[model samples]
Target: MSARPEQREDRRKDPVDAIVDQWAAVRPDLDTRAMEVFGRIFRLSRSMGDRMEKAYAPFGISRGEFDVLATLRRSGEPYTLSPRQLSATLMLTTGGMTGRLDKLERAGLLRRSPDPHDRRGLQVTLTEKGLDLIDRAVGAGLAVQSAGLSALDDEQVGRLADLLRELLAGTPGADH
Candidate 1:
């Protein structure tokens, strides 16, 4: 039989391909397209997450901490938000947010102050140090990601991004 389109295009036998082949051998009746796609996505996420963790490590932050700092940095001037806002944006629980805030505050990377408009609420603001660290960390993280994507050309990357966006939009409970 002639090689499949994917096989003809690239003869690589990735882990996901190996898995699909095993399943096919055992149960040829099963359809594994979704498994193949999601399996590759899952593996990519894991591997990239590790690379990102390492990328942020030199700045003395984990991926989660980087998320917190990045969120604030992207918020623009004054770089302040309510604790509740931060929790919501990060999709983290209030307790979890508190732990991160405590650590960042202790490290002098951020500050917590009583909200002037709301006596009962508190505001979180990024310190100069936090902003500087996040700026550098973001660049490093992007470098690592760019290197990983170097295998694909610009058009291929764009197409992949569009496809992933479509998949994410259709996914249940995913943010629009």
Candidate 2:
């Protein structure tokens, strides 16, 4: 399903409309057909993120915050990791991870301390409060994600995941 025509009509008149129009004119000979599927995926990703954010609202945490806490929770016993470890594991830069840690700390969900093994490093640990919050938030997030995927049966979802994985693996920088 898509947004109503009333919503789409407004976008069609927007500035970026010219890009698609030009593409259609210049590439009439080539297939250029994959654009339809990939373009919708890009657009739907944005809309789906908005929906997921709204679903996280009741927990009073942004999705990014939840991601950090969840990562720490899943790291096994002691439920702690160094800032460097978290940043690398989450594919975030050091500065970006620091900002996330600051917000979570202010929310009383996590705490930071000097790493015992490395003077230059810091360990980020989920506070008891942070652990509880993530536990609940994760449950809610799963429900929302499951509902979103309900349009496809379990078997279909499995096949789709496999195909996507194969495609991703064949792409350059996938291993990087």
Clashing pairs in 1: none
Rate residue 82 of model 2 by lDDT.
92
Tell me, by TM-score, which candidate is best: 1
CA RMSD, predictions in order: 2.5, 6.8
TM-score of 1: 0.94
Report the C-alpha lDDT of model 1 over 117-136, residue by residue, as the tens digit. Answer: 99999999999999999999
If scored against the real structure, what TM-score would every candidate get? 0.94, 0.80
Q: Which ten residues in a row have the lowest lDDT in candidate 1?
A: 1-10
- The candidate maximizing lDDT is 1
Clashing pairs in 2: none
